[model samples]
Target: MLRSLSLLALIAASPVVAEGARELSAHEHGVGELNIAVAGSDLVIELHAPGADIVGFEHAAESDADKAAVEAALAVLGDLSSVIALPAAAECSVSAAEAELHIEGAHEDHDDHDEHEAHGHDDHHDDHKEHDDHKDHDDHAHEDHKDHDAHDHDEHDHAEEAGGHSEFEASYTLTCAAPDQIETLDFAYFGQFENARELHVQIASDAGAQAFDVERDAAALDVKGLF
Candidate 1:
Protein backbone atom coordinates (compact mmCIF):
# COMPACT_ATOMS: atom_id res chain seq x y z
CA MET A 1 0.00 0.00 0.00
CA LEU A 2 1.15 3.52 -0.73
CA ARG A 3 1.97 5.65 2.28
CA SER A 4 -0.72 8.21 3.07
CA LEU A 5 1.64 11.18 2.57
CA SER A 6 2.92 9.73 -0.68
CA LEU A 7 -0.65 9.13 -1.82
CA LEU A 8 -1.50 12.73 -0.95
CA ALA A 9 1.43 13.99 -2.98
CA LEU A 10 0.54 11.79 -5.95
CA ILE A 11 -3.12 12.82 -6.01
CA ALA A 12 -2.55 16.41 -4.90
CA ALA A 13 -0.92 17.16 -8.22
CA SER A 14 -4.24 16.85 -10.05
CA PRO A 15 -6.90 19.59 -10.15
CA VAL A 16 -9.56 17.36 -8.69
CA VAL A 17 -7.26 16.14 -5.92
CA ALA A 18 -6.08 19.66 -5.14
CA GLU A 19 -9.62 20.98 -5.09
CA GLY A 20 -10.81 18.18 -2.84
CA ALA A 21 -7.98 18.67 -0.37
CA ARG A 22 -8.45 22.42 -0.37
CA GLU A 23 -12.22 22.22 0.08
CA LEU A 24 -12.00 19.62 2.83
CA SER A 25 -9.10 21.31 4.61
CA ALA A 26 -11.11 24.54 4.67
CA HIS A 27 -13.30 23.12 7.41
CA GLU A 28 -12.23 24.64 10.70
CA HIS A 29 -13.83 21.61 12.33
CA GLY A 30 -15.17 19.65 9.40
CA VAL A 31 -12.49 17.90 7.33
CA GLY A 32 -11.13 14.35 7.29
CA GLU A 33 -9.29 12.01 4.92
CA LEU A 34 -9.61 8.38 3.91
CA ASN A 35 -6.97 6.20 2.21
CA ILE A 36 -8.06 2.93 0.62
CA ALA A 37 -5.79 0.24 -0.77
CA VAL A 38 -6.98 -2.80 -2.65
CA ALA A 39 -4.13 -5.27 -3.03
CA GLY A 40 -4.84 -8.79 -4.29
CA SER A 41 -7.83 -9.88 -2.22
CA ASP A 42 -7.04 -7.69 0.76
CA LEU A 43 -8.54 -4.32 1.48
CA VAL A 44 -6.98 -1.74 3.78
CA ILE A 45 -8.58 1.55 4.71
CA GLU A 46 -7.27 4.35 6.87
CA LEU A 47 -9.15 7.37 8.19
CA HIS A 48 -7.64 10.50 9.72
CA ALA A 49 -9.10 13.78 10.99
CA PRO A 50 -8.67 16.58 13.52
CA GLY A 51 -9.53 15.67 17.08
CA ALA A 52 -12.29 18.27 17.23
CA ASP A 53 -13.87 16.55 14.26
CA ILE A 54 -13.80 13.22 16.05
CA VAL A 55 -14.62 14.02 19.67
CA GLY A 56 -16.24 17.47 19.48
CA PHE A 57 -13.34 19.02 21.48
CA GLU A 58 -9.63 19.24 20.75
CA HIS A 59 -8.50 19.83 24.31
CA ALA A 60 -7.62 17.32 26.97
CA ALA A 61 -10.48 15.41 28.49
CA GLU A 62 -11.40 17.30 31.64
CA SER A 63 -14.62 15.38 32.31
CA ASP A 64 -15.89 11.84 32.05
CA ALA A 65 -18.15 12.87 29.21
CA ASP A 66 -15.22 14.15 27.18
CA LYS A 67 -13.31 10.91 27.54
CA ALA A 68 -16.37 8.87 26.73
CA ALA A 69 -16.95 10.76 23.53
CA VAL A 70 -13.45 10.06 22.30
CA GLU A 71 -13.73 6.41 23.28
CA ALA A 72 -17.08 6.08 21.57
CA ALA A 73 -15.77 7.54 18.34
CA LEU A 74 -12.77 5.25 18.35
CA ALA A 75 -14.98 2.27 19.04
CA VAL A 76 -17.17 3.08 16.09
CA LEU A 77 -14.19 3.54 13.85
CA GLY A 78 -12.77 0.19 14.96
CA ASP A 79 -15.93 -1.73 14.19
CA LEU A 80 -15.52 -2.81 10.56
CA SER A 81 -18.96 -4.34 10.61
CA SER A 82 -20.58 -0.97 11.17
CA VAL A 83 -18.44 1.86 9.66
CA ILE A 84 -18.74 0.27 6.18
CA ALA A 85 -21.32 -1.69 4.22
CA LEU A 86 -19.73 -3.83 1.51
CA PRO A 87 -21.80 -5.52 -1.16
CA ALA A 88 -23.05 -8.94 -0.10
CA ALA A 89 -21.09 -10.52 -2.92
CA ALA A 90 -17.80 -9.11 -1.65
CA GLU A 91 -17.74 -11.01 1.66
CA CYS A 92 -15.04 -8.93 3.31
CA SER A 93 -14.05 -9.74 6.88
CA VAL A 94 -11.91 -7.76 9.28
CA SER A 95 -8.41 -9.10 9.83
CA ALA A 96 -6.53 -6.56 11.92
CA ALA A 97 -7.25 -3.12 13.33
CA GLU A 98 -5.37 -0.25 14.98
CA ALA A 99 -6.04 3.36 15.92
CA GLU A 100 -3.86 6.27 17.04
CA LEU A 101 -5.38 8.73 19.49
CA HIS A 102 -2.93 11.31 20.84
CA ILE A 103 -5.35 12.25 23.58
CA GLU A 104 -4.93 11.73 27.35
CA GLY A 105 -5.22 7.95 27.69
CA ALA A 106 -3.38 6.84 24.59
CA HIS A 107 -0.04 5.13 25.14
CA GLU A 108 1.54 7.14 22.34
CA ASP A 109 0.57 10.40 24.00
CA HIS A 110 3.47 10.30 26.45
CA ASP A 111 6.07 9.54 23.80
CA ASP A 112 4.70 12.20 21.46
CA HIS A 113 4.72 14.74 24.30
CA ASP A 114 8.33 13.92 25.08
CA GLU A 115 9.32 14.37 21.45
CA HIS A 116 7.45 17.68 21.22
CA GLU A 117 9.12 18.99 24.36
CA ALA A 118 12.52 17.99 23.06
CA HIS A 119 11.87 19.84 19.81
CA GLY A 120 10.81 22.97 21.72
CA HIS A 121 13.91 22.79 23.91
CA ASP A 122 16.11 22.53 20.83
CA ASP A 123 14.54 25.71 19.42
CA HIS A 124 15.04 27.51 22.73
CA HIS A 125 18.69 26.49 22.77
CA ASP A 126 19.14 27.86 19.25
CA ASP A 127 17.46 31.09 20.25
CA HIS A 128 19.72 31.40 23.25
CA LYS A 129 22.78 31.05 21.02
CA GLU A 130 21.41 33.65 18.65
CA HIS A 131 20.86 36.04 21.53
CA ASP A 132 24.44 35.55 22.73
CA ASP A 133 25.78 36.29 19.28
CA HIS A 134 23.69 39.44 19.09
CA LYS A 135 24.95 40.53 22.54
CA ASP A 136 28.54 40.18 21.37
CA HIS A 137 27.65 42.42 18.39
CA ASP A 138 26.08 45.02 20.70
CA ASP A 139 22.52 44.38 19.43
CA HIS A 140 20.61 44.51 22.72
CA ALA A 141 17.74 46.41 21.07
CA HIS A 142 16.86 43.44 18.86
CA GLU A 143 17.18 41.09 21.83
CA ASP A 144 14.77 43.17 23.90
CA HIS A 145 12.21 43.30 21.06
CA LYS A 146 12.30 39.50 20.70
CA ASP A 147 10.51 39.18 24.01
CA HIS A 148 7.35 40.62 22.43
CA ASP A 149 6.70 37.27 20.78
CA ALA A 150 7.30 35.42 24.04
CA HIS A 151 3.54 35.23 24.59
CA ASP A 152 3.42 32.56 21.93
CA HIS A 153 5.20 30.32 24.39
CA ASP A 154 2.04 30.16 26.48
CA GLU A 155 -0.03 29.28 23.44
CA HIS A 156 2.41 26.55 22.53
CA ASP A 157 2.18 25.14 26.01
CA HIS A 158 -1.59 25.16 25.79
CA ALA A 159 -1.36 23.32 22.49
CA GLU A 160 0.80 20.64 24.07
CA GLU A 161 -1.68 20.28 26.89
CA ALA A 162 -4.65 20.07 24.56
CA GLY A 163 -2.95 17.94 21.88
CA GLY A 164 -3.27 20.95 19.51
CA HIS A 165 -6.01 20.25 17.00
CA SER A 166 -5.78 16.62 18.00
CA GLU A 167 -6.05 14.14 15.15
CA PHE A 168 -6.80 10.42 15.01
CA GLU A 169 -5.81 7.78 12.45
CA ALA A 170 -7.68 4.50 12.33
CA SER A 171 -6.43 1.65 10.16
CA TYR A 172 -8.47 -1.40 9.18
CA THR A 173 -7.40 -4.42 7.14
CA LEU A 174 -9.90 -6.82 5.61
CA THR A 175 -9.80 -10.03 3.61
CA CYS A 176 -12.37 -10.18 0.83
CA ALA A 177 -13.64 -13.37 -0.65
CA ALA A 178 -14.83 -11.70 -3.85
CA PRO A 179 -12.49 -8.82 -4.64
CA ASP A 180 -13.83 -8.52 -8.19
CA GLN A 181 -17.27 -7.71 -6.96
CA ILE A 182 -16.07 -4.82 -4.76
CA GLU A 183 -16.41 -1.52 -6.51
CA THR A 184 -17.85 1.08 -4.18
CA LEU A 185 -17.40 2.16 -0.59
CA ASP A 186 -20.46 3.08 1.41
CA PHE A 187 -18.49 5.04 3.93
CA ALA A 188 -20.56 5.56 7.05
CA TYR A 189 -18.20 8.25 8.32
CA PHE A 190 -20.32 11.00 6.71
CA GLY A 191 -23.33 9.97 8.74
CA GLN A 192 -21.23 8.96 11.74
CA PHE A 193 -19.26 12.19 12.05
CA GLU A 194 -21.49 15.16 11.40
CA ASN A 195 -18.78 17.61 12.39
CA ALA A 196 -16.63 16.19 9.61
CA ARG A 197 -18.59 17.36 6.59
CA GLU A 198 -16.03 16.60 3.87
CA LEU A 199 -13.45 13.95 3.04
CA HIS A 200 -10.79 13.30 0.42
CA VAL A 201 -10.50 9.65 -0.56
CA GLN A 202 -7.61 8.07 -2.47
CA ILE A 203 -7.69 4.55 -3.89
CA ALA A 204 -4.76 2.57 -5.31
CA SER A 205 -5.12 -0.75 -7.10
CA ASP A 206 -3.97 -2.82 -10.08
CA ALA A 207 -5.97 -0.77 -12.58
CA GLY A 208 -4.47 2.48 -11.31
CA ALA A 209 -4.97 5.12 -8.62
CA GLN A 210 -7.77 7.67 -8.39
CA ALA A 211 -9.09 10.30 -5.99
CA PHE A 212 -12.65 10.97 -4.91
CA ASP A 213 -14.31 13.81 -3.06
CA VAL A 214 -16.86 12.90 -0.41
CA GLU A 215 -19.33 15.30 1.14
CA ARG A 216 -22.32 15.11 3.48
CA ASP A 217 -24.71 14.74 0.55
CA ALA A 218 -22.66 12.05 -1.20
CA ALA A 219 -20.83 9.63 1.09
CA ALA A 220 -20.21 6.84 -1.41
CA LEU A 221 -17.63 6.68 -4.22
CA ASP A 222 -17.69 4.63 -7.42
CA VAL A 223 -14.60 2.40 -7.57
CA LYS A 224 -15.31 0.19 -10.57
CA GLY A 225 -12.17 -1.68 -11.72
CA LEU A 226 -10.21 -0.19 -8.82
CA PHE A 227 -9.63 -3.74 -7.54
Candidate 2:
Protein backbone atom coordinates (compact mmCIF):
# COMPACT_ATOMS: atom_id res chain seq x y z
CA MET A 1 0.00 0.00 0.00
CA LEU A 2 2.87 2.36 0.73
CA ARG A 3 4.44 1.70 -2.68
CA SER A 4 1.09 2.27 -4.41
CA LEU A 5 0.63 5.60 -2.65
CA SER A 6 4.10 6.66 -3.63
CA LEU A 7 3.40 5.81 -7.26
CA LEU A 8 0.20 7.89 -7.20
CA ALA A 9 2.08 10.82 -5.74
CA LEU A 10 4.65 10.57 -8.51
CA ILE A 11 1.90 10.53 -11.14
CA ALA A 12 0.31 13.67 -9.64
CA ALA A 13 3.62 15.54 -9.72
CA SER A 14 4.37 14.45 -13.29
CA PRO A 15 2.20 17.15 -14.84
CA VAL A 16 3.86 19.94 -12.87
CA VAL A 17 7.23 18.67 -13.96
CA ALA A 18 6.15 18.47 -17.58
CA GLU A 19 4.62 21.92 -17.57
CA GLY A 20 6.98 24.73 -16.69
CA ALA A 21 5.93 27.95 -14.97
CA ARG A 22 2.57 29.37 -15.97
CA GLU A 23 2.47 32.66 -17.86
CA LEU A 24 -0.23 35.30 -18.13
CA SER A 25 -1.73 37.12 -21.13
CA ALA A 26 -1.98 40.85 -20.72
CA HIS A 27 -2.88 43.98 -22.68
CA GLU A 28 -2.43 47.72 -22.41
CA HIS A 29 -3.96 50.72 -24.01
CA GLY A 30 -1.73 52.34 -26.58
CA VAL A 31 -1.51 54.52 -29.66
CA GLY A 32 -1.16 51.54 -32.01
CA GLU A 33 -1.75 47.82 -32.42
CA LEU A 34 0.11 45.50 -30.04
CA ASN A 35 0.06 41.69 -30.43
CA ILE A 36 1.85 39.13 -28.28
CA ALA A 37 2.39 35.37 -28.25
CA VAL A 38 4.23 33.05 -25.87
CA ALA A 39 5.21 29.41 -25.76
CA GLY A 40 7.14 28.04 -22.83
CA SER A 41 9.83 30.69 -22.24
CA ASP A 42 9.49 32.21 -25.69
CA LEU A 43 7.51 35.41 -26.23
CA VAL A 44 7.02 37.52 -29.35
CA ILE A 45 5.49 40.97 -29.79
CA GLU A 46 4.43 42.41 -33.14
CA LEU A 47 3.85 46.15 -33.54
CA HIS A 48 1.99 47.56 -36.52
CA ALA A 49 2.16 51.16 -37.62
CA PRO A 50 2.13 53.61 -40.48
CA GLY A 51 5.01 55.81 -41.65
CA ALA A 52 7.68 54.07 -39.56
CA ASP A 53 6.63 55.34 -36.14
CA ILE A 54 8.69 54.50 -33.06
CA VAL A 55 7.32 52.19 -30.31
CA GLY A 56 8.12 52.10 -26.61
CA PHE A 57 6.81 50.27 -23.52
CA GLU A 58 7.62 49.93 -19.79
CA HIS A 59 7.72 46.39 -18.35
CA ALA A 60 8.33 45.21 -14.80
CA ALA A 61 9.24 41.77 -13.49
CA GLU A 62 9.07 40.92 -9.80
CA SER A 63 10.93 37.64 -9.95
CA ASP A 64 12.49 35.08 -12.24
CA ALA A 65 9.19 33.22 -12.01
CA ASP A 66 7.63 36.31 -13.53
CA LYS A 67 9.72 35.50 -16.53
CA ALA A 68 7.63 32.37 -17.00
CA ALA A 69 4.43 33.48 -15.32
CA VAL A 70 1.27 33.26 -17.47
CA GLU A 71 -0.58 36.02 -15.69
CA ALA A 72 -2.02 38.72 -17.91
CA ALA A 73 -1.20 42.35 -17.08
CA LEU A 74 -2.64 45.54 -18.51
CA ALA A 75 -1.18 49.02 -18.79
CA VAL A 76 -1.27 52.05 -21.00
CA LEU A 77 1.67 52.49 -23.35
CA GLY A 78 3.01 55.63 -24.99
CA ASP A 79 5.51 56.52 -27.65
CA LEU A 80 8.35 56.58 -25.13
CA SER A 81 7.36 53.53 -23.00
CA SER A 82 9.25 50.24 -23.20
CA VAL A 83 6.65 47.74 -24.38
CA ILE A 84 7.68 44.64 -22.44
CA ALA A 85 10.62 43.20 -20.60
CA LEU A 86 11.40 39.92 -22.29
CA PRO A 87 13.54 37.08 -21.06
CA ALA A 88 16.75 36.23 -22.88
CA ALA A 89 15.04 33.17 -24.35
CA ALA A 90 12.30 35.24 -25.98
CA GLU A 91 12.17 36.00 -29.73
CA CYS A 92 10.30 38.72 -31.66
CA SER A 93 9.51 39.69 -35.26
CA VAL A 94 8.25 42.97 -36.72
CA SER A 95 6.73 43.80 -40.10
CA ALA A 96 5.01 46.72 -41.88
CA ALA A 97 2.06 46.43 -44.24
CA GLU A 98 2.18 47.87 -47.73
CA ALA A 99 0.02 50.96 -48.00
CA GLU A 100 -2.86 50.55 -50.45
CA LEU A 101 -2.12 53.84 -52.08
CA HIS A 102 1.52 52.91 -52.42
CA ILE A 103 0.69 49.53 -53.93
CA GLU A 104 -1.58 51.20 -56.46
CA GLY A 105 1.11 53.69 -57.17
CA ALA A 106 3.59 50.88 -57.77
CA HIS A 107 1.27 49.16 -60.18
CA GLU A 108 0.81 52.41 -62.06
CA ASP A 109 4.55 52.78 -62.14
CA HIS A 110 5.02 49.31 -63.59
CA ASP A 111 2.54 50.22 -66.32
CA ASP A 112 4.40 53.43 -66.96
CA HIS A 113 7.64 51.50 -67.19
CA ASP A 114 6.15 49.25 -69.82
CA GLU A 115 4.99 52.26 -71.78
CA HIS A 116 8.32 54.02 -71.36
CA GLU A 117 10.28 50.98 -72.47
CA ALA A 118 8.18 50.70 -75.59
CA HIS A 119 8.63 54.42 -76.33
CA GLY A 120 12.35 54.17 -75.63
CA HIS A 121 12.76 51.31 -78.06
CA ASP A 122 10.90 53.27 -80.72
CA ASP A 123 13.03 56.36 -80.10
CA HIS A 124 16.23 54.29 -80.20
CA HIS A 125 15.25 52.90 -83.56
CA ASP A 126 14.41 56.40 -84.79
CA ASP A 127 17.78 57.66 -83.54
CA HIS A 128 19.55 54.86 -85.40
CA LYS A 129 17.79 55.85 -88.63
CA GLU A 130 18.60 59.55 -88.07
CA HIS A 131 22.22 58.68 -87.29
CA ASP A 132 22.50 56.78 -90.59
CA ASP A 133 20.92 59.72 -92.45
CA HIS A 134 23.31 62.25 -90.87
CA LYS A 135 26.51 60.22 -90.59
CA ASP A 136 28.57 63.41 -91.07
CA HIS A 137 26.81 65.26 -88.19
CA ASP A 138 28.29 63.30 -85.24
CA ASP A 139 27.81 66.32 -82.87
CA HIS A 140 24.00 66.34 -83.33
CA ALA A 141 23.87 62.57 -82.72
CA HIS A 142 25.87 63.05 -79.48
CA GLU A 143 23.46 65.75 -78.28
CA ASP A 144 20.42 63.53 -78.95
CA HIS A 145 22.04 60.66 -77.06
CA LYS A 146 22.72 62.95 -74.08
CA ASP A 147 19.07 64.02 -74.00
CA HIS A 148 17.96 60.38 -74.03
CA ASP A 149 20.33 59.61 -71.17
CA ALA A 150 18.86 62.43 -69.08
CA HIS A 151 15.33 61.17 -69.71
CA ASP A 152 16.36 57.69 -68.57
CA HIS A 153 17.87 59.12 -65.36
CA ASP A 154 14.68 61.04 -64.57
CA GLU A 155 12.55 57.90 -64.93
CA HIS A 156 14.89 55.94 -62.66
CA ASP A 157 14.71 58.61 -59.96
CA HIS A 158 10.91 58.62 -60.01
CA ALA A 159 10.84 54.83 -59.64
CA GLU A 160 13.26 54.95 -56.71
CA GLU A 161 11.27 57.61 -54.83
CA ALA A 162 8.00 55.71 -55.27
CA GLY A 163 9.66 52.66 -53.81
CA GLY A 164 11.11 54.56 -50.84
CA HIS A 165 7.88 55.85 -49.24
CA SER A 166 7.70 54.73 -45.60
CA GLU A 167 3.94 54.93 -45.20
CA PHE A 168 2.32 51.48 -44.77
CA GLU A 169 -0.36 49.48 -42.94
CA ALA A 170 0.77 46.95 -40.34
CA SER A 171 -0.45 43.47 -39.37
CA TYR A 172 0.95 40.44 -37.53
CA THR A 173 0.37 36.73 -36.90
CA LEU A 174 2.27 34.61 -34.36
CA THR A 175 2.49 30.90 -33.68
CA CYS A 176 3.62 29.17 -30.49
CA ALA A 177 4.24 25.47 -29.95
CA ALA A 178 5.14 23.33 -26.98
CA PRO A 179 5.36 19.60 -26.40
CA ASP A 180 2.02 18.29 -27.63
CA GLN A 181 0.70 21.88 -27.69
CA ILE A 182 0.33 24.70 -30.22
CA GLU A 183 -1.26 28.13 -30.30
CA THR A 184 -1.61 30.91 -32.84
CA LEU A 185 -2.47 34.60 -32.50
CA ASP A 186 -3.14 37.15 -35.24
CA PHE A 187 -3.93 40.87 -35.19
CA ALA A 188 -3.87 43.98 -37.35
CA TYR A 189 -4.12 47.73 -36.79
CA PHE A 190 -4.73 50.47 -39.34
CA GLY A 191 -4.12 54.12 -38.58
CA GLN A 192 -7.30 55.91 -39.51
CA PHE A 193 -8.41 59.10 -37.81
CA GLU A 194 -11.61 57.74 -36.14
CA ASN A 195 -11.96 54.04 -36.87
CA ALA A 196 -11.83 50.89 -34.69
CA ARG A 197 -9.24 48.12 -34.69
CA GLU A 198 -10.18 44.48 -34.07
CA LEU A 199 -8.02 41.81 -32.45
CA HIS A 200 -8.69 38.06 -32.25
CA VAL A 201 -6.48 35.74 -30.21
CA GLN A 202 -6.76 32.05 -29.31
CA ILE A 203 -4.96 29.43 -27.27
CA ALA A 204 -5.49 25.67 -27.35
CA SER A 205 -4.37 22.71 -25.31
CA ASP A 206 -5.39 19.07 -25.05
CA ALA A 207 -7.31 20.04 -21.91
CA GLY A 208 -9.37 22.91 -23.38
CA ALA A 209 -9.36 26.23 -25.29
CA GLN A 210 -9.04 29.91 -24.36
CA ALA A 211 -9.92 33.11 -26.20
CA PHE A 212 -9.34 36.77 -25.46
CA ASP A 213 -9.93 40.17 -27.00
CA VAL A 214 -7.75 43.28 -27.03
CA GLU A 215 -10.05 46.27 -27.20
CA ARG A 216 -9.53 49.12 -29.64
CA ASP A 217 -9.36 52.80 -28.86
CA ALA A 218 -11.19 54.74 -31.53
CA ALA A 219 -9.18 57.75 -30.63
CA ALA A 220 -5.94 55.79 -30.85
CA LEU A 221 -5.88 53.77 -34.11
CA ASP A 222 -8.68 52.49 -36.29
CA VAL A 223 -8.78 49.48 -38.68
CA LYS A 224 -12.43 49.28 -39.60
CA GLY A 225 -13.96 49.30 -43.10
CA LEU A 226 -10.56 48.45 -44.56
CA PHE A 227 -11.35 45.29 -46.47
Question: What residue pairs are clashing in model 1?
Answer: 51-166
| Number of the predicted model whose TM-score against the real structure is largest | 1
- lDDT scores of the candidates, listed in order: 0.65, 0.34
TM-score of each: 0.62, 0.21
Report the error of model 1 at residue 109, Å: 8.8
lDDT for each residue of candidate 2 in 37-142, tens digit (9 for 90 to 100): 4454343444433222221212222255531221111111111123322222224332221111111112233554443333333344457567768655466555
**Which ten-residue region of model 1 has the weakest summed lDDT?**
18-27
Cα misplacement distance, residue 41 of candidate 2 (Å): 3.5
| TM-score of candidate 1 relative to the true fold | 0.62
RMSD of each: 15.2, 24.7
